[model samples]
Target: MKKIGIGICIGIMCFSSFFSYGNEQVLPHHHQIQKGSASYIETINQEKNRYVNYGDGYMIDYPSHMEVDTSLEAVRTLIKDQEREIEIYYDNFHNTPNSAPAYKNYSNAFIKNTKDHIKEYENTATINGMKVHLLKWSRKKLSKVSNDKNFYVSAEIVKNDKEVYTIFIKSSRQFYNFEDYMDVISSFKIIEKKGNPSINTKFKPVERKLNEETKEFYYKYFVNSDKLRWGIFEQSAPASFSYLKGIENRLDYEFKFLVRYQSLDVPMPLEELKNAYNNNRYVELTLQTMHMNEENESITYDILDGKYDDYFEEYAKKIKEFNHPILFRLNNEMNGDWCVYSSYYSSKDTNLYKEVWKYIYHVFEKNGVDNVLWVWNPHDLSFPNFKWNHYLTYYPGDEYVDIIGLTGYNTGNYYPGEIWRSFEEVYPHVYNEYMDIFEQPFMITEFGSNEIGGDKVKWIHEMFDYMYMHPFKNIKVAIWWNGIDWDPLRNPARIYRLDNREDVMDTFRQRLKDYK
Candidate 1:
């Protein structure tokens, strides 16, 4: 039996060597040989036979069967790409069915410390009569142009104790049929060899590193201010104040301003908006809500034409007269595509959008409007793209903008603790990037989570907890999306009136105390 086995092995070696040379006959057309040819395969097989000298290890089995070229470079490249997907998978695994709080904390830390992109990884596994090792993972490209671009990764893990086989597959798609593949993956069984066992290592918790620039920003906005700490907004000024008075003991909240987005000709003209904002009653005021510009399209730039130009001038004059910190958010959420102003104005055409914002700022300056902190509020559409462009489209330059504000209200729409899909993710990344670019203060110009099961209190507390930790700098104000209509666009705002529900009062008071 031993002699027969030896003969068979020799025959296999000769057969492999015979075809491994420069033999185009064996090469497949349309498939260029990277490195592994017949000869290379023979050499690798030879190496495998001398397993007594090399160490053996174990890992999960490859779920699929595909040609795995034995080229070192190809294998290395494949392994380099899969590192992130693998890490994320592992994180999810450990976090779930484990400890939620610990997972959250650890995940945050891991995200902070992750510096390099995936380069490579290797692990061994054994299946039926074979030895498998997860040998490679690599990062193919950066997510620059396409968010949908697959994060390319490759895996070559051996399965079964007898086969000495490997499989390569995409990390993103590999785990889809997780249960079906689990049996194969679990078949990995490592064999002991002569080499000493290397140090056993596992993924560690990552530390959240605060950017130096961002740290300096917080110092300027939150810590530096004594009286003018936080800008507060509400639908009903009187009602909001009663809630404000309740929280006044704990927080130095600023009643920024209270005004409606309607025709400038109503009640007392645009000047009343400025006076209400400046009297120290509030620090910011959104002025004359002009008709949504559908024809020209760009929301920020679609001025109320020459007819309302005088009213706008008069509004500027009032701001100049009072000389108080008032935030002027002209046309907001223009990037949403739903709002008429955003639909028409948000365009790549430079003059198209800039011209409008420029006109507004230029007129305000011409009217000698100072003490007015111009806030450019963009709905947090999404990160890297949506909000960034829309918010910045009609920036009106540095001279005009004092604060960069983002509006994000929690509708009873989304699940609590669930990471928001579009705007939620956009908020952090956008805040970081914008601050890096503009170095100006950022605000949640408007943000509030609606009630679920009449649990608005819990919702508010949770949202506030998130902010208390990762506070945006230069955010002198935050307006709740609470109002009677509850329409996010028209009258989004918090019901902070003294006569309002005591629970509302309690929530505000607690948040103020926590902020302090």
Candidate 2:
């Protein structure tokens, strides 16, 4: 999933190539320019969201739930699943007497991009004060596999000024409310803002808390505190305690938490939780909605429809009875295509992802499960990193999440395309981004260096040094994944164990002894 996510995000995401407005790298009123930046749209108080693209210098009240796609050179596509999309094109908006109006090219760009369509309705009218060329069309034969004559609506309004824009949106199944498209067209605006654009940092976390004593204790001692807890996940979760016990004995160093990965195909990790809590350690559950052995199945839709309500309800009851602060990380690394819950499988509809999260969160809340600190996690990078599939798009919001969990790994050269990553390379880039925007505490939910990559010893030693650096903020816990990711063909593909060598254990022992 890490490799898949990295490939998609890095290859598909780019913010530049939109039109410029004013003299100071601003957007023109209706002109086209193919050189600008991108600030993808998202997040709000769950209201009718007005997204402000600080990078492109535009503000529009787009439905917050919808996804944005800016992978195109000078186009911003607002999409609602596979069927509906709004393409906003920005081209060179300057005009010369010797040639056609630059804004006139907005219509041409639209025609150049869209193909194989039959026009249903073509007319001209002023819907939102701006005269628009209205068009409604459809493609009867979608493809060889499916003849989904999915409906399409389109229009073009080019002006003498640089204010030219192609208008189009995908409608639902066979029909759509025309007013919806009109409203979207009217909402477009190009303006100026002062500072550089950033991920929304003005966000305020929802006021959710646990029992008074525990809540206060956690906030004071753990969340955002100077204390850093070392965590681990062994090869087999059930035998993890026995394996971890050996490590604890070797260096007289105890891990504060244990991490486990489980899919919803089985029961919750009651025994694992018991093992950790009994031993005075916390447990981080990397919960997933897919079948553990079968990666193809995704039950996110079923989960939303309440098919698994009883399952979660039972777990909620158990968790509350357990009465410990469980780091409940539901569906970690969601932005990766290798994850069943990613939008890649859902027609790029991330709303379903966010919906399942809120549904799960609400179920736990209804059962009064206060001991669970909801951990919303994403891969350090996004798969397809298209604006629609970005990690931020999957965030369930402040009220629903308590901790912002992060995951990255150095897989070494075990896989065909995998590469070794230094601690500095894997962490600081994402850390800096999260530090600016998130209010919740951070955790390296899962990470490790594969012995196949570079110097595993040096990686471990350098990891300790990096962790001790004071420049980082709000990072409370870091967990090492101490297991082998075996390839069917290459059996021992990647080894991440810290106790594989006395020298390696010595490295951790020496560094940890002086940590405090």
TM-score of each: 0.46, 0.68
lDDT of 2: 0.63
Over all chains combined, what TM-score does candidate 1 have? 0.46
Model 1, span 379-495: residue lDDT tens = 665221211133443445555555677776544433334342333344567666555445455566665554432466665666566567776554555665444333446553333
Give a tens-digit lDDT track for model 2, residues 1-516.
001111012222334445432233432222111123344332323544444454545555456455544433223434444456555543324542221233332222222223334456667776445566676665433221122324655544544254444544655466556665666666666556444432322234566768774587468645648877777786554335676787878877887877877777777778778877778777787788887566343366456656687888887788877777788888888888778788666434455677778777877888888887788889987754334456776777667877888888887897775778998988988888777657778888888889886898899878878777644667787888887887887698988888888888888888878544
Query: Any runs in candidate 2 off by more than 4 Å, and if so which?
Result: 1-174, 177-197, 236-240, 295-298
Off by over 4 Å in 1: 1-228, 238-279, 292-305, 343-350, 382-390, 414-427, 453-455, 484-501
lDDT of 1 at 14: 25
* Model 1 lDDT-worst window of ten: 1-10
